[model samples]
Target: MNVGLGLPVDDPAALLTWAKRADAGPFSTLGLLDRLVYDNPEPLVTLAALAGATSRIRLQTEVLIAPVHRTALLAKQTATLDRLSGGRFTLGIGVGGRADDFLATGLDVHTRGRRLDEQMSQLRRVWAGDAYGEGAGPIGPAPSRPGGPEVLFGGFAPAAIRRVARWGDGFLGAALPPRFMDRLFRDVEASWKEAGRPGRPRLVAQTNVVLGPDAVVEDARRNLARYYAFTGNAAHFVDGLLTTPGRIREAVTGFTEIGADEVMLYCWAGDPGQIDRLAAALHG
Candidate 1:
């Protein structure tokens, strides 16, 4: 299975250093997480810098919250970044649930799904045309890719799956049960077939992965804590689910079996040394 690495870093120089060493050629793609108040740089700005620093590694936004920003402006920014990266950008978008973010933007989280749907429709229209005017066509500074950056929408619910079918070029799976992953894929495939779409869209799943027997227990616990915290799940359950390197491999293999085209493993390492060890194991 194709594997990508997503490292959430707080420092731009550290991010740059990681990208440069990444020229070692192990990861298929590298992604940045999008969260404004998390003491992290903005995803597109970081990726714009990455596009300049690296030549071949694919750059991704593991997801940008669509409801918080204007759709046309977001598409333009993404297209410009994609142009700079020579079409190596994949725009992963989702409706984020952070209450602070919503409060900051003064957007209603209750209407996020409907707002995203409208925004996506408007984005496609604006990307495909010039202005919403008569004399204009083809937006200036178009993306290096013919139809703009590939859109990867993420969510696990049935409604979410349908939204992806309607607008996204692929589905990005969050932390979901194995059986539910199967159901999600099935729904997507059925949606494509029903729509008479020619080929299946890409499917990428993200999960926390541990790579060593010598890995620090505290780091693993912290990783589980953050993972569970995001899902509102209790961190205690993850210890039994992914306690060993063998268990990690088994879970990945199971995801592959369920039609995951690529698996992007969040190294789950909070310390510096853990990064190298995790990458080495992923490369191996």
Candidate 2:
């Protein structure tokens, strides 16, 4: 299975260094998370910068908040970056769960799911040169690829999964419990077949990781609390994926065994040395 690393550096210089080093590492892609107002920079903006700095690593938005972005503008931005990076961008998008984010955007959080559906449809239209309106032909400049970056949909609901089969080129996010994963993957395949699509969509799942023989469960517990607070899936949110170095390796192989095309590791290692050590363990 293809393996990737989530880059979540708080410092810009350190982020750049890690992005560059990650490209040099064995990872297949560099996944970045998106939040409009946060410690980290906007994902697409950060990705544009990384595109200029790295040559080969495929860049991705692990989950871009669809409600906050202007659909057409985001399409253009992604296209420009994909062209800049020579067709190395994957747009993984979701209807975000953060109510505070919607409140900050002056939008009703309750409508985010519908907004995500609409925005995704609009993005496809803009990318395909469909008229933006009666007078506007389309947004430009066109991406180097015939279509813009491939869009992957992520979420853990039936509605979200249907959208993945309907609109997205791929499905993303982790699967919980081996049985649930089997069912979800099977359902997605059936959905694709039902759509009369030719083949199964790309599948990627992320496993949270913090590597060290000395790593404490408290570090994971603390991080899990923060994650659960953000995503609100407290039951499965924090507890399922967080693991020690040895457990992480086993889980990665387990995900691979379940037929995931790629497995993204959410590296929570606190420093550069830790990141290097973790990468070495996975890469080696």
Which candidate leads in TM-score?
2
The residue ranges of model 2 lying beyond 4 angstroms of the native Cα positions read 175-179, 213-224, 231-238, 241-243
- Go through the candidates in order and give each one's C-alpha lDDT: 0.73, 0.76
Give the clashing pairs for model 2. none
lDDT tens readout by residue for model 2, 1-284: 68888875455567788778888877888888887656656889899999999999899998999888887788889989889999999999898877777778899989888988888777778877787777778898788777668888888888888888888888886536444676777677778788888877888887676655445345554555565566566557556755556666776777777777888877644445556766667655
TM-scores, each model vs. reference:
0.87, 0.90
Report the backbone clash tally of model 1: 0
lDDT of 1 by residue, 1-284 (tens): 77777764634567776676564556667777776545657889889998898998888888788888877678788889989998899998988877767777888988988999898877777666557336745555677877678898887666667776788888888666455677788888888677777789788888765554555555655655764575576564365435355655666677899999987766555444545665555544
The residue ranges of model 1 lying beyond 4 angstroms of the native Cα positions read 132-139, 177-179, 212-217, 223-244, 270-276
Which candidate number has the best lDDT? Answer: 2
What's the residue-level lDDT of 218 in candidate 2? 51
